[model samples]
Target: MSDNSSLLRVSNASLLPPLVDWTPPTFTPAAQARVAATMVLFVFAAISNLALLISVSRGRGRRLASHLRPLILSLASADLMMTFVVMPLDMVWNVTVQWYAGDGLCKLLCFLKLFAMQTSAFILVVISLDRHHAILRPLDSLNAHRRNRRMLLTAWILSALIASPQLFIFRTVKAESEDFTQCVTHGSFHERWQETAYNMFHFVTLYVIPLLVMSCCYTCILIEINRQLHKSQEGESLRRSGTDMIPKARMKTLKMTVIIVMSFVVCWTPYYLLGIWYWFQPDMVKVTPEYIHHLLFVFGNLNTCCDPVIYGLFTPSFRADLARCCRCRPPADSPRSLDRLSARHESDPPKAT
Candidate 1:
């Protein structure tokens, strides 16, 4: 019985010779190095963002912190989902000589992975627009409840709507290599038209329109800040001191907005450009030697990992909440305690109410 089993194993191995090619040329040293570097960066970013999320979710902070809880959780959840669901499958696809996972998994993984990615992108754009409204129109009744539950529901709905098409379009195919299979779109003239439609949807809804909205919002906020600062200069000495605080706060907000926009551009622009290039000139760029493709896959996954870090830097309340969520030491004291300290430090008599 043992001899028969061994013989069957040998026969199977012999029959599947091309499927498990392990030659050195299959993945060059430089390509491997690039993959390693990208993987390291991706892991680091993911871990950092996860830590930030944990800290915010558990820590003792202001009640207003609850307002951003949904958004933070959504971002972190998407990133975490991608790290586990997408990255491993992508790594396997890039390195293996064949598609061992079958067609069902290929379609499911491709759909879920791209859907999460698109969802994350859409969420970020929503956040930018939300911030713009809050900052520019602080007195407006709408801005008063920027953290409304309905707003979060809308964000999720929009994200889902934006990502839905990926489910139907992505497909797995057997490739030229005997052992190898890949998940690629089989775009016939009709399918190609569908691809074009989805691409335009992605471009217009996710990138172009969001960016324009962000630009307009930021512009209005900046102009408002500038006007406030100019008005501050002509005020009484005490009023000037009060107004001076606005400029500092505005500067911080501006810095955060710039960083968020820059991070979005840096992480996404290459992937989008490469995607467009591939769509138009599929033969021009070949990702051979397995590892090069691995690097590109890792690079694309990094955006989801990096978003939480951007949020942490921009929002102080978020940072404080994140610390609490992770079971970090409690903050020094409440806002009332700080007020008492300020009162003790002042020597001048109180002004008339």
Candidate 2:
């Protein structure tokens, strides 16, 4: 009886459970579909952004307004960052189901992910404001280059500043029970409310503020344009004098930017709203299917693939640029092509007379 009791004590000690329990994340069918969708979005965004960047840097896009080039470049740069940073991070995180990289990479990548998102939102705001200035105060166009430079600088700075918190909040947490680690914000906030507050702050700044500013700017622009049209219609003498109250080129650019903004809102609103619902009702995670969030995230990434397509649709030069690139021709050296591109650019806007 004494020997049996000794054996039982040793077995009980050996079978003691870990302090913290962890269940290893499974790669479900929904996760698999997400990875596949993410890969497709990444490829399309990368190619489209690279093409748009090349078109603006060396191709006929040189003919675009000096003030406008920076906006397009900044947009493309932000989207590329999303493609290279966010999409890959998401794919790897889902596939590995745990943190393979060390603590430092975890924080840095989270910072970059937030930074890219902020930059994308802020740059769109900047573009809307620029359009507002261009339409309402055309006489101030000479200062647009300096004005746009200042705005772009501020956008980048603000994005970096806002995203800096990720450096401290995100870290690699080990689950001793499963002997696995994950990059998460598990213990960053002492209270649950603190984490909710932090997320709400980001959500407001990232989506709500930008959406409001853009909507206001575009509304004012439309009102001004309508007033101008009404004035022109009523005044036959002004029409006969060959005065264009609004530049046709500016209008085309405005239309393109508006479409880009709409795409951003439409693609992201559902995802963001769902996130808010989940944050407020944590139990929704158990009640809701995982594929719902996965699909929403995939849909949000679709916005990155929309911008370049919108630009190409509005700009005739982009079509020519695409053709030249596809044919593997020297875009800059073709005088005939340059002339044709020049003609198309000028012809896109109507003459006042």
Candidate 3:
């Protein structure tokens, strides 16, 4: 009886769990699969963006650099940085289930992610506004190059200003149950308005304001295009082309803008919605952590892949550029092709839409 009692005590001690503040959550197979798939998508998105850049460079290098406009280059450059810097860090965090880059790097990477996102949002705003100027306000088209440069500069500056707060807001924390750390952002006052301030700021500046600007710009652009088309037709009712040429050309431009704007709304709205939903700490409700993380990346990364598709579909020249880069055409240096390309560029340098 005494020996049996001692054995029971020993078994109880062995079964006891470790004392720790927090334990890493069990990684289920489904979650693991979802992360792997997300990373795979990111990799492909990066590849596609790179392909776009390469095609732009190659086509232009073989032809003229004028085709590689500052706006497209800036947008693509941001996406490329995300692919290399932000996305890889996110993948590492997801896979390892921790933030292993230490505290300093944690701050830098966090800042960069926010900055990259802001840059993307504002770049779209500039693009939409530029599209308006390019089409409806054709008088400004002459200064398009200078305007693009200024906007690109402003976009990065604004993004940096917005992202600066991350340094103060994010920090590294270690799990007591596991030898792992994570970098997370919290309000200055952990249990107070700090969270609300941060959350609302991100939602407003990154999502809401940009949405409004782009929406208004595109709306004005469409209206002006329609108005101008009618005006031209009314005046050219008896002309030989009968206003057919101008309307057709303008419609083509409008169609491209529509695709670009619509794709932005569709691909990006979900990510921002998800971001705001994350902060809905209600009176008697809670949100699941796993659900947000799993889908956040999937939604955000969709925009990266969508850009190239939009370009390929709406920009006929980009498709031709890509094909030429892919070797679907004969050597660009062939005297005949060279002469043709030179004539095309000379007549009208391919405007970066």
Q: Give stretches of model 2 more than 4 Å off.
A: 1-19, 240-244, 328-353
Better of 1 and 3 by lDDT: 3
Question: What residue pairs clash in candidate 3, if any at all?
Answer: none
Q: Tell me how candidate 3 scores on lDDT.
A: 0.59
Q: Tell me how many residue pairs clash in candidate 2.
A: 0
Clashes of each: 11, 0, 0
Expressed as tens digits, the lDDT of each residue in 247-310 for candidate 2 is: 5567667788899999999998987887677557756666777788788888988999999999
State the lDDT of candidate 3 residue by residue for 142-177, as single tens digits: 466677788889989999998898787676765456
lDDT of 1 at 122: 59
For each candidate in the order shown, give its overall lDDT on alpha carbons: 0.51, 0.77, 0.59
What's the distance in Å from true for residue 333, model 1? Answer: 10
Model 3: worst 10 consecutive residues (lDDT sum) = 1-10
Q: What would the per-residue lDDT of candidate 1 be over residues 3-115, giving only the tens digit for each residue?
A: 11101111111112233443222444544565566567668766766775665466431222333455556667767766766565544543552356766775667666656
**Most accurate candidate by TM-score:** 2
Of the pair 1 and 2, which is ahead by TM-score? 2
- The worst-scoring run of ten residues by lDDT in candidate 2 lies at 1-10
